[model samples]
Target: MLKKNLLAIALLLCISSVFGQEMRNCGTMEVDARLLTEDPGYALNQAQIEEFTQTYKSSETGATRTVITIPVVVHIVYNNASENISDAAVLSQIEILNEDFRKLNSDAGSVPALFSGVAADVEIEFCLASVDPDGNPTTGITRTSTSKTSFSTTDLMKYNTYGHAAWDRDSYLNMWSCDLSSGLLGYAQFPGGPAATDGVVIDYNYFGGPAYAASPFNLGRSATHEVGHWLNLRHIWGDASCGTDYVSDTPTHNTANYGCPNYPHYSTCSGSPVEMTMNYMDYTDDACMYMFSDGQKDRMQALFAPGGSRESLLSSEGCGGGVAPTCDVPGSTSTTGITETEATLNWGSVAGSVGYNVRGRQVGTATWTEGYTTGTSINFTGLIADTDYEWQVQTDCGGGDLSAYISSILFTTSGGAATCTDIQEPNSSTGTAGTISTGVTYNALIANSSDVDFYKFTTTSPNTKIRVTMTSLPADYDMQLLNQKGKKKGTSQNGGTSDESIVWNVNSSGTRYVYVYGYGGAYDVADCYELIVEVSNSSWRTDGSELLVERVLDNAIVNIFPNPASNTMQVNYFSVQETEITLNVYDLLGNQVQTLHSQVVQGENLIKVDVNTMAAGLYIVEISNGKSSYTEKFMVE
Candidate 1:
């Protein structure tokens, strides 16, 4: 009995250590365990999946002869603006999935030569759903504003009350991208599970392209890993010591490996087999994990066989080509050469159409002004500055018949002014500087083409780590950290409207400067950005930790209950020290609707605000001490 207890304790320790690393932590096993305990029928379902796997492997004709395409729907639930990722990000994830599953990824050649022969194409494809379950045209992406700060495996985020609910699981692969608490990169549900909760959950930061993707997990491989689990592949280590992953091709691993390990990593398990750290099922960093083995591909294909758990998806018309009759809809529609007052819209030529008609309108307005173009593109000028406009293109097939207008694409015009008076100038070096410290966020803007904002910061002690993040922007911006001698220590220049961030752990204390500038000399007076510079002795945490910073109002505890309130809303907060607090609310259009000032004690306080008259929409609740401020989102219904 004593020996058995010791072994169990050791096993628990091993599992805990594996999860403690800064790597992908999938919760499928835990969710499955919970389901098995609550629903006895789930065991029978899992057993059926296993039986199908075995039978399919033994049958010669069971191998997938043709490619299988899976339809996908992405549900983005966000509390703040940044969490509501862009459509381009979601499309980038789909592109990554297709490349990796078909062995078309550029990194496929990086797979170690020893494992290259067994690297399977898997013959699988993924596409965003063009038609929703209601038989209506859709983009397959749903956005929901939630009061919940973070989601866990309880699947509360899967419901409409808390967030956007899943689509029909039998016909679509439901993917929820939100702020997952803890350091979890993502999680997945295996083939045999309740339909209501059948899907995958990915951390918003790890779901998309490199613009917002963090290091180590930024390659959009988290979804690839989670999807592998959803298709019935287990962890490379089998989640146990020397245990089988049920796939015969992969070598036995003692445990999950974190970061990028050196090649030929030999496991301590029996035979001292060299671990396949490059396998997608392993816990290595995204850039390190690349290929799937033949055995694992067979396992996924088994689920699509007749009478299998996911066989219904084979008949799903969600892939767009089969369900809808062939019509020349505009493709690759995009905008370029955008300025404060004009934009150039472009698209690929539609076959059968001689010319196209373009229409533009403000997003919330009803009227669209139409223009005709003989070529594939058109230019719209005389647009208002600092406003969002939606535009669409219709194919003119000839004889007065025009195809229906494609879905509207949105773009926001830049602020007209090239400069602002509020921001301090000439802070580009330590000599002319605005003082900054750790744990405080500063808001500023680049006023014009020549505008550059800089701040000089000092560390009180040695071996301090600092992280700088630039967000809430109006244009593409980049940042750099320089030492006292003007040598660049780090730089971040993410493209497009994505946020820029940089981290540096200095070994010695000294003066440093941060230089912020607009990309390609672009700047706007009306659009301000926030810079968060955090200095700590401890190592920097994951992106989730940075999100927590957005939650708190600088050392104050604030909570708003019953969000999406129909009547009165209660605001509760704790003042760490005596401070004057101001509360304000704003709408999506940046209009301030309500404001209140309060003198608070050092402890807890509650204030009720009447929101009955407010319209049903998203609102930002901002609480600020005299020195610092924080904001959260709440919905009024």
Candidate 2:
């Protein structure tokens, strides 16, 4: 018996080693799938979540224009001293989140112009909770020491019995940083899941500043990506072959993209479209992925809309103000002459200020090396190459009390050499136009902020719809559509790392021109934008019948009602033809509690389920026609 037990343990260890070797792994899907199999109620909750999201997206009044601030509580579960990350590292992650979500990251300029128009300022902010759950002042960070060297999706790290328990999840976004057993970087529970474990779990090594974080995954993007899932965003690839991530703006990816990929990496899926490797939802390295699409922002913002799963966080006091300050906030900060090891930082001169206290540090480092500058500009030296750094300025008002430090700005040192080669010139007008077709993709560098590129194409037939898209790198680029006479027919000029797109349907078969220019004359030699012009003759209609067809194909119009039921629940379903169906109920552990075999005729069918004797927790109801399946979740009272 002892020998057999030893053999079993060895085999388990071997299996873990094999599965944990991947460089990047997210346990969200695994955990979610387990929940769907065990807890029958999770299905209904997810359906309601989808319905709420759809309602918010369709209602003009439900649009979330204002910024929503979420209170964050970081729980550090460390087995050793080094695992207890520093406050500076924690602060750096918070700052990075603020920048990335608001489209203020220093690398925002690197997004290709083709995708920049869809990039969004999520208008969401995160701040450390100033008060604990007990109404006491807190730093919004907690630490717990454990004997376990590692953890997995069993959530041992989330409970106080083993490591740390979450705070009030409804009022705070709980983030637990720990040493995960596998190579898993992180995972998050989507909205509508159990509240006790409702938050994001990040591997401690991948959670914070550079001093402790590992390379390739070190820029604090792991938390950014996981938080995205917590806010209801799915993988850009939809976690399946040619899957739909449910966001229209993001291009369909066949699978995850790891590391940094060159621009215009074409997908092998239908249409052979170019992949968006830089999207945060992809599996790329931290420094590689930078932007989120507008559609993704809409989905995230829906959680804060009224009647949404996370709406309660809207009233949280986690970010309540502190004591008033005497000094004014600094403004108008800028960086210039950036190189591999040096950068020049400048800020607006503050009134009543005698001297400025400047502090700078490599991103993810704990301590800020300080410098005193009497003038408006200061030159920083001894910086690392291709590294991200942040600096802040404070006013010294002569007395002992100095003004508060203003918001920090981020800058990245130049990479030693550039590998870009797609440089094009003399394509600014019809005479010098670069010939392009509907299906082919072209690449070019703006060279500088002042540079612009032009291309010309001829329509083969009347009633053709032309689409011109430009994606830029490290700068904002805009596009304009012009007729053969050089008259501007349409333009798209979204700000930040968003892409620019211009579509025009013409009745006449003639030559047309496309003008691509940088926004605010911004450009970079190392980064290039991709341009794809697609011309199609298909009739363009405004009616939304196409979208309806897509929905019906995805699901057979199944509905469940009287959720949080006390006695009975109704399942109403529609099918085009008569089919045999099976209904099953599951618990949270993925165990089948009950099953019913039934048949449905063409059109609508109603089936009633009695839940009076069921347990008072979440349950899942899964209906299958042997060909397809639909699941919903509900609660028993």
Candidate 3:
């Protein structure tokens, strides 16, 4: 049995020689120096931290020392199966860190009598994060597969390009493990650097204990040393001859010592005192390095103190003990009561929902005309004739925890005539104003006493003078022509709709809107009234005293489509007479791509521009009447 055991040990050593690194090399100082040249602010921030460390005093032991538990997020960026380590390996690393920092390791007794009195427990612990930044549950280990074989000290492993992005650095200790460049075991970013690259890194080959790691550098001490640098601990020799490590109790050393050194190893600096080669921050082999001095403990704990650099970490809920987040989407949705101008939507309620947010739009449009409601069903009116529409419902669970919007429900409206019944039934608000072309007569009914109609139109320079005629009357109705802002510019209140009209003049040409409603709840459900909007150069004149009109309109008669060609997104423009207009299409970068000079008839003009040749993005359609320009943007995807 003894001969067999010896052969097994020899076999293990041979395998380790293939993958193990014989010497430890940390790149923390090199990375810091490179960043100091790249960013001046990083240098200034580091200087302030050094200034604080030089002035602010820390104590090793007291009732004031509180054990700090830091939440940790481990990003495993790997190129192959071997580099993608298991969760067990990560848990082992966490266990080793806790044992070493608390001075609870089984090998703590190996410290020499001369240094045992000064050996200290740093009073710091770490935990795999239980909650993610999005308030969702997490396993704390993020695994990402990469195409690159290895990463270097440039921090490519800490970003989403080749690896995983860091969690909120202020709330979690971000650690990345990957295949490092040859001979580079690990590195750490010190405090007071850019948050994007702030973290510690380790090679996957040296990430865990003996069960999964190689020899010489195995046992996870590589992380212990790098983490020390993350918390502001420097090399024992300070990376220079007879240099200071900013700690008071550590004996001054001439240079770094490698492997296991015999005790009473004398330094050539000052009185040539015995060096503490067993310190975790030294270059000694893993089995030879163990304890931290009391001075080092105080410096590590300073990060959690008030006004300290990492003080905000104490309030992080990433480790648990907070209200759990809960929100869910709607269930079992259906549409009913379809009509040319009306419809209804219904859905089942989700648990924990106090209310719901609902919105609807034409199938190709981007904006949703909606609001919040406590009811499970919503009635929609002022819908376009023979058009497809989509709407969504979301559950609101209070405390700002809102669920995802449920899948959209689609429905198409039935086609109908424009007479007798109010085709634009729901244009009750300015936000839902219906489109009306100049000189086109519309016959719509007054459904009830509270029914109102709003109509909008676009006019050109020759058509700046406006004339709206409302001849047939069902009740005493009123009309108000307003600017695009819904401000009333003119009104005509001829008693009993005795052929009411509004004629005025303006210096400019653009879109204008009008509102029509009954006076004091008057209506005739069966009769339809005729209304029309017209403009000319010299027909009607205004005295600047009053206004007149006798018609009504409903919700929007336009659509916005994020597609190559949708309902073609009609652009409305009118002139007092027949004329030619120039239309141009330009990309978002201000480069013109298409132009067309077309003749617009005296009545309604429908122009469709083909965008199948363009790539997916946003574009602007401009219409110029040789006097003024009207522009609207559309998307193709």
Candidate 4:
């Protein structure tokens, strides 16, 4: 079903007219005029023209070299059935936009001889938005799935759904691409009139179709025409009968004419002369059109003036000209911090950028230590812990001037030091022998022979996610998350021979339990194990939000007797709880698992919980109160 639509048909004579006939009026004309030039077309009277001229001349005299940047967000509304255009295609279109707007179209040489003389070098550039309206870095393109391929004036609302995902509009230009219902390939709504629909829409066939389709003479020209609308330029043929396109030089045409026509064609208007077939707003094939009259430039620049829609883009405050803090990484934030065991630097690159330099120093030091020609992100190791240090990054833009230095903001290294203040219990069993912070508990077991070990834990939250990493693995072995009574979660190969971890995402909430067992066979001597417990942070209540920290099961000593016990059970603690202890349980679905206990204690203690009345199933024993927690996988068989 992939086939060409009417956009590629032979030129037909179907009464070419303004797509928005009813919507055309003086208000629209005035807005378009105000965008390309300071003077509105309605104000062409001696008074308005003279005033605009004076202001413009004075502004020109004091103007400094400036480049106005507009962020862009592209929304690709496709059927989502075909090969989804890759992200690379989205970026390619952005590149084409920048190249075309700056008059750097790769096909400039291909312009027909009849139009070469009028080819206009529009002085502008575009960039993908570095910051979305929500203030996040985005490549600036979105995609939506739909069954319908053809869009019309009413379909314009789709651009909003596509663009609303952007962080902001005043800061970003939204462009939507889809199949159109008519001969129209693309159209821009121009900014201001309505916030509900404030963006441009282009037909997909005219967007990035191969080279010919991509030519400024083709797909490329659509962007030019739409941007003109974006910048407030009226069509050269105007909107109605003798509707002034506003530029005095463009010979008036009664309606849109297709293909190229010889000069000297007569018009009904007074001074009737040849038509301006080279104007971008004409319906002729892209190769037949060119130029934005000086009058048009005036109108375009007017939009960035005091009363224009894009005036905010012209302010000195809006310009970000300070040196970019250099980094070993291109997209990373630069800041001062402790000398890292591994230090990395990054920054943006221009074509031909050769190498980079890294400089660093201990905190408070006057001189910086330098490193030679390096690429992005350099790692430094063997540094003293608990010390402060700063680093700066610089890039060599080929043989041109060197980029400004980017420095790291102030930061320190502390957690690595043995004497750090945040250090709570160096030993996992410090506070309680068999308890973690809350709703999680851990018990170790030593194998008599060389076999796998089984463990259990519970949670209090409706659902749970249990991940286990070996605090310290036995010599050579492995483990897995096995099928329990509730549900099977996930399993992962441990980092080493005897270590493993798993994460389970579930919809069910409340106390739930989970179980774990070794991979190979039964228990074996010298096979020591340590256990850590965890609960998912998907809870609605914020008070216990921190209860969801990642934990690795460690240690292998104690045991719970009467496997699948009926009532009371013995929890042998290798050590004693000096203060408080917390415990909870959970199901495999990761729901709360369940809360087994919450209380303070002092010394070696063996506590028993009734299970004879408990339903038969798999559960997790989560033990924690405030500071920390432990986890174990158990079952009530």
Candidate 5:
């Protein structure tokens, strides 16, 4: 029996060696030392580490499972196309991160028998940050569309388009995932280096792909391995010619050998037995690897030392707790005539809240009853009439701390005869031209209100159609929605026909605003217009058909499409005017592509850009109208 067992072990080792030898080139890979030595890279030195260690409480306990939680932010830089992965993909990666660190990888059980016994679960947890550096609520993900690809990972830290947002590095781990050059799976900025770029960058392929196209294994766990390096964990092969991973329990080898390897292996590094192929730090097929040694855990812990970039993250405030200086309150109100069952709630974000603890109490009632509050907002089922209620929210910061709470706010449900008014004047300085009312009141006097083009108010106890009548309009017009930044989000034209009076289906529990932009460049004579929005007991609400039109109107690009135009030609100008414009064409090899039109209108002016006179090869169309110029690529079809 003993002889059989030895033979079986020997056979398994041989198989492991073969498995570990499988090779696949990840493509012209080279680590930029200059870039990697930043905050999340080689930003920290021995002095910094020592200083941080002095402040570490671990010297007090010396426990391996120090129970440290790292906040993370995922930036997605992609073309506006499908490469801009869904929000679910980003969240899924976060879930996988927590699972891997906790030794909860679903494939751990499938790990080879020889390595299963050594699978070490690195005790750690990752979470999407709730508070930004300025302490505002965040989903921890930012998206940007850029014409440039193959962005250097280090440059990502400096450009806002990449992910630079003055974030608190110690409290947040920044990770950028994008389309990198083919073959390169991913690279990370190690901690304790020059103080520049911070975080990891992975080509989108390995980020969420099935795995084979990018290499190793499937299920897109490359982020797991790269993030390990991000936390200061070295590759399982010790990142040296001698593949000794330094961890006492791991075997020795003469360099990292990718692919599955046999157990109890032999190595050329001083005749030491084969190395541990299942280390999380090694570039192995995901299915064949599982484990993070205790030494790696120690290195990661060392990163959070006092002076390290991850130092501030160890604080209570950094962990998402303590008294919130901001409002952090959650409140809901309803529109009249609409059943009080549905209310729209808007509130400030509370710190440490995994979610929220929203509870409410009816008017004239002292006992506060618990209400729904899992996500940012919730829909209530049954509600009373002609009643006022107070609501409050508490932060669910992990750990045992729960004393954090926001003050309550009161809102009454309208029983009948609702009058919704704005606390401030309706803004009219900004909005889509011809889509808003630019009457007298929209002039210079309304300073703070300039950001708000309009305001809306609704009551729920009863539903109603708000008949907005202009009592003092020099001329009548419509309104448009404005985003938080005072940018036009939606627009509606009044057509300059009659003294405009528009009817809006306002929700009983929802209130919003639209700004007015006067057309014809003439300011209304009325000093202050009266908008007596009448509310009727009608169950009419705006179906989801409302469209949010976001147009780029800067005239920045003069795009001419169908260069080798046949019949219909389109010229896209950021700001096309009614004036005539000119277009010139040029050909390849330093020659003129073509000039289809000599004069075209300003806005979306389409000219034949006479491609009929051109050939069936490549060409460029340049459009210029004294004010701006744009070039576009087209071919004769």
Candidate 6:
């Protein structure tokens, strides 16, 4: 080692003259300071990482190292054609990174003999991501046109409102190439920071193409330097005079060197050691700085330790291990153009799809009628009215790669002219829930093909057993039961126009809500379906079954008990859905009597009224919901 240092002194003696040039500067620290000031979470993240790295680097020695490949996505935010660099420029930058990190560059041998002993091959490689976050094939490049002439450390280019939002940071290393504001080569966010702005930003002019690269910074070392910061390597100068760069092997520098200063220019701190100006973390020109020290490599590798923030990157399938990834399945299916005989099925498009396999079958049947279409939609014909059917789609990715089918979507063809008007208005959400009386079979519309109905009904002691049943098929419908606290109690999703029902044996007696809606945007304007919220003191299995309860399916009245009652005589009456009803007693002369009961009901109901203040004569009971009326006779003797 003394001999190598003496050899370094010999190289130092060889260069006597020096010249001044524009010093290369990076904005990484400036951005880090800003984020630390503005975002508290970012500061905490940095603190935690710093603590871990401190302990890890000091305690761990000679640990086995493995080659870790990171997937990269280059985002091009440009204003003019000049800023929109070609694919070759981006690829060249990646090549430079591979060369520098893996010690595969042609200049590896050119490293000074003094520091060559501590130079490290970082065992890290980067590949352009093959699969995007959405599981679609990609070139690992994204180009966006922006109005801004140039971006600065403010990072306006990293957002969609200004330029383009970042891809998921956990999956890929994001690099933005743009015309930077005035004078800046590049900057990078450290390992621990917010995901939105987490990446390296490079000047479009210096983005590593030999044809367009400017002098001194042309060899693409700017990206290598910035990515080093991104991987948690401080500048070799530590941004201080003879400050610690956290790597023990590297020599402390007086300050940032410019124009590739001659070696052996010693800092006045501690050992007055010869500055390692050729290190990539130093401020040397691109062609001059080429090596990472063993300590620096260990520092960067610590970020991928068991509890590291970048650990998730180890599991990313973005490269698919050099194999072509599987095709993405179809998403979010919809049905339209419905009739008694046919309807249209549509879904989102899949990337690189050669065709889509569409399949449909009647509900409760196994046989599916499959068809093919190159477009995103297909027409289903020869259908039956009021029949329940389900369909699914799979993407044909070509090359014998087919994706699995998406979940089946349900629909029912309209046929019967069950024209009914909407009853409950403004009952769209829980906040505007309308009151529903138990045992009343309410008829309401899904109206305008997109209505969601919410209703609240109260239960009583021993009668807390609630069963909500939706009948008279209008479209694909679903029902859900919620407790007073808005927690889901039970849900019934029997797809298609088939009757949907949910039975809940609730123990408590409070207001429970019933949410009814057409599945998959299914609704009708002029058709109304029957919804019955039945409450009974009857027993239920709690394992998904219900016993019987007394409810008048058909409207009826009378069956007056006692024969000759005095006060508060039982006047049994039946009614369904929101309605008004009345009961009256008349003498033998047919004179009018007092009205017994008159109110609106939400579902099937049975009411008792008093006949006490009536004369000993015959009387009549009547019930009506304005749509229909029922009556019977008895004596108030």
Q: What's the CA RMSD for each of the models?
A: 17.1, 26.0, 26.8, 24.9, 23.3, 27.2
At residue 417, give the lDDT of candidate 3.
49
Better of 1 and 5 by TM-score: 1
Residue 93's lDDT in candidate 1:
96
What TM-score number comes out for model 5?
A: 0.43
Q: Rank the candidates by lDDT, best first.
A: 1, 2, 3, 6, 5, 4
Q: List where candidate 5 sits over 4 angstroms from the true fold.
A: 1-32, 35-66, 110-118, 161-166, 194-196, 209-217, 243-246, 262-265, 305-309, 316-637
What TM-score do all the candidates reach, one by one?
0.49, 0.51, 0.50, 0.40, 0.43, 0.50
For candidate 3, write residues 1-637 as lDDT tens digits.
0010000000000111223447777888767655543443554465456556544543324335768898998999999999999999999998888989999877889999989998988888989999877566889999999977888776768755468766778899999999988577899988887777888999999998888787787888999999999998888876655655767788887877877889989999777889999999888888999999887876777666777778888999889864454688788899999998778989998888889999988653335789788879899789876666778888898888887676567888885543475677678867787788888998776666578888888887844778777768856777788886888888775444345567666657888887888754455555678889878775342223233232211110111232234335444443445777777876533567789888877644556666666665545566667654444445554
Candidate lDDT scores, in order, read 0.75, 0.73, 0.72, 0.47, 0.50, 0.72
Summarize candidate 1's per-residue lDDT along 1-637 as a digit string, tens digits.
Answer: 0010000001111132354456567676766655543343564566567667877877833354689999999999999998899999999999999999999989999988888888989988999999876455889899999988888766767766457666778889999999987677788888877777889999898988687687778888999999998998888886655655767788888878878999989998777888999998888889898899988898898888888789899999776754442446789989999898899999999888879889988643435789998898899898867767778898888887666677668898876764334455668665787877777877777766678888888887886877677777777678888888767777775443456666675657888888888765556666678887878786443221222211234455555666656798777665668778888887534567899998888866777888989876556677778766555556666
Q: What's the lDDT for candidate 4?
A: 0.47
Q: Tell me the lDDT of model 6 at 57.
A: 79
Instruction: Output the worst ten-in-a-row residue range by lDDT, candidate 3.
Output: 1-10
Per-residue lDDT tens digits of candidate 4, residues 215-325? 333445666677777776666665544545545446677666565556545566555656766566666656655555555655566556665566655532212332332
> What clash pairs does model 3 have?
432-555, 453-553, 454-553, 492-548, 501-548, 502-548
Report backbone clashes per prediction. Answer: 0, 37, 6, 116, 61, 6
- List model 2 lDDT by residue over 158-243, tens digit each: 76645676777878999998888667888888888876688999998888756668877888889999999999988887665455
Winner by lDDT between candidate 6 and candidate 2: 2
> How do the residues 239-308 of candidate 5 rate in per-residue lDDT, one tens digit apiece?
4445333244555545555666666556666656656666677666766666675555656676665555
Query: What is the lDDT for 192 in model 1?
Result: 73
TM-score of 6: 0.50
Clashes of 2: 37
